[model samples]
Target: MTETTRTEASKLMTEVEGISGAVLPEPAPAEAVTPLEQASPQEAEGIRQRMAELDMTDTTSIVQFGARAQSDLQSISQEMLSGVKNKDVGPAGDSLRQIVTTIRGFSVSELDVRRNRSWWEKLLGRAAPFANFVARFEEVQGQIDKVTDTLLSHEHKLLKDIKSLDLLYDKTLNFYNELGLYIAAGEEKLREIDATQIPAMEQAVADAPEADKVLHAQALRDLRAARDDLERRVHDLKLTRQVTMQSLPSIRLVQENDKSLVTKINSTLVNTVPLWETQLAQAVTIQRSREAAGAVREANDLTNELLKANAKNLREANAEIRTEMERGVFDIEAVKSANADLIATIEDSLRIADEGKRKRADAEKDLVELEGKLRHTLAAANSSKQAGGAV
Candidate 1:
């Protein structure tokens, strides 16, 4: 890790320790004394032999392990970042909006009975608004069902994301634990080089002759380089561990958001939908009752109108019958009018008979005159014919 990262990690660790009320052991000093100082001659000689046997190759496995751990940590970090980025609640918000719109679309006014319609319109069922109301209700219910399905799907996705986050959290913790072990191992190896191996190599270089000093010094340089490499590896592991630590909370935060969305979806399904449906059903019932009452009122009004008209017609007819019953069998005025009509008919018949007789007499006289004229015309024709013959 860089110096700044190290400093930050240390501060974070200190804060954690303070909150937990647990004091961590202090790190070993750079110049701490080694066991070699207290050892006997044989032990010291054995340690010197072991230090001489140590080569740069001994750290190869540790370096490879660190590299592998770093790669794994990188992969874990990337997976976590990608998961967090890809998770979204926009679909849930859309479902909520759909729900609100569906709820707002409900209007009881649509169910109101049309009172101004004519009797024929009611008889034909045109004035019955319940059919349209029921259709609208069904349509709104279908919309609600669609919203519910969408919410449920979104909730399932959130649940799946939360499960993935749990797995990611576990992986991060594992990486953190692994990094702790790697850092501990690297620190121990570094302390060994600082306290024992390098010191032994330095002593050997000081005691050797000039020609051999160069070889011992080169070995010392190699040991120091290995120590530096181990330190760098430890720092790299610490940085990776810090990344895992940060990832822990990030995964949890994303999971929390998913959980919150799931809770809201559950509330919408379990509470809001049921309550709305119940209220809608009640409204429909009330509207039906109102329509029934209106029908009854219209029937009563029509009955009253028919009764009043019948009563008025009956009164007029009864009055006319009472007047006819009160009068004589033959009314004087009716008899007088009938007698006058009979007399006028007789006079018209007599006048018509006299006129026909006179016309017939005149016709007879005209016939006699016509016959004389025909005879005279016949004689004239005969004389003219005879004269022509004699000539």
Candidate 2:
């Protein structure tokens, strides 16, 4: 017999109970005994509760999510002007001269990753970046934990990942709840820099020094490239958030459906098992437990109706997401033009570096040959003078 079964009988009803008024122990609290009673229920309820808590399964979206961003549009000299004023402009005209020359000598390049964002995504991200931000942070933390464990010998990747998510989630929530308005206000300032400040500054870079222009140009190109990468990543993230969010209810439906299905199965098994067990033990049998019989009958009808109605809706949502994924498109021309001037300045510098190495090698070889010729000429001249003196 099970430990539970052994403890459950009426203690065999002591003999001479009429003379000695048989004593019985107090019953355990209902809450305390409840789990014990449910233990024979096959643990299906526990699994069902846990299944409800997960949010990842019902997802069918691939929409990006994160902060709204504009791709790069400012050049090197313009970048400096954006950050500085007249005194800083001291003799920049000379820098522009050399920068132009440097560009002529080197193979300049502007690099930007292709990226795109639709109005719908921009709207969503601006409306709710936190959802995507949290996911991004979690993903980053997972990568960190994986790398750190390999490099630092830490074994608790899951613990580390969860810890990072907890901290990031708390920090981000506080920022949005307390400081989001301030961040929203800062958006106007960024917009102004883009629409007014940067353009005017670029036009005024007319007299920058050649060397400064070269360095500034390269810096600007690098900066633009970095921004391009960020915008692409954010766009990708925003799309993810959108698709996942959309798929949530359907996924939850599926999860609830799954639990109902399992509960029915387990309840059916337990009901049948007990029907036989009870018959063997006490020669008593009930055709069905109330819950098992009801669940079996109701769940089949309920789930069948759900599949008939909601299955088509899930299929329609899938089509919408698939259309978006297939039509991946973005315009990066503006970004390239903005970084173009600075990139032009690097071409000359790169070429000069390569040519300088070649020139130095040739000069060394020439010097070696000249030294050998000089030694031979000196010996012949000395020998001619010695022969004339001997004669």
Task: Give the TM-score of each candidate.
Answer: 0.48, 0.24
| lDDT tens readout by residue for model 2, 262-302 | 23322322343234334333311121243356568788989
Best by TM-score: 1
The candidate maximizing lDDT is: 1
- What would the per-residue lDDT of candidate 1 be over residues 10-109, giving only the tens digit for each residue? 4433333332343222222212223454555764554454344334557765466455445665686687567556546887888888878877876656
lDDT, each prediction:
0.69, 0.38
Candidate 1 scores a C-alpha RMSD against the true structure in Å of 13.8
Model 1 vs. true fold: TM: 0.48
Worst 10 residues of 2 by lDDT: 106-115
Candidate 2: RMSD to truth: 54.3
Please report, as a residue range, the 10-residue window in candidate 1 with the lowest summed lDDT: 24-33
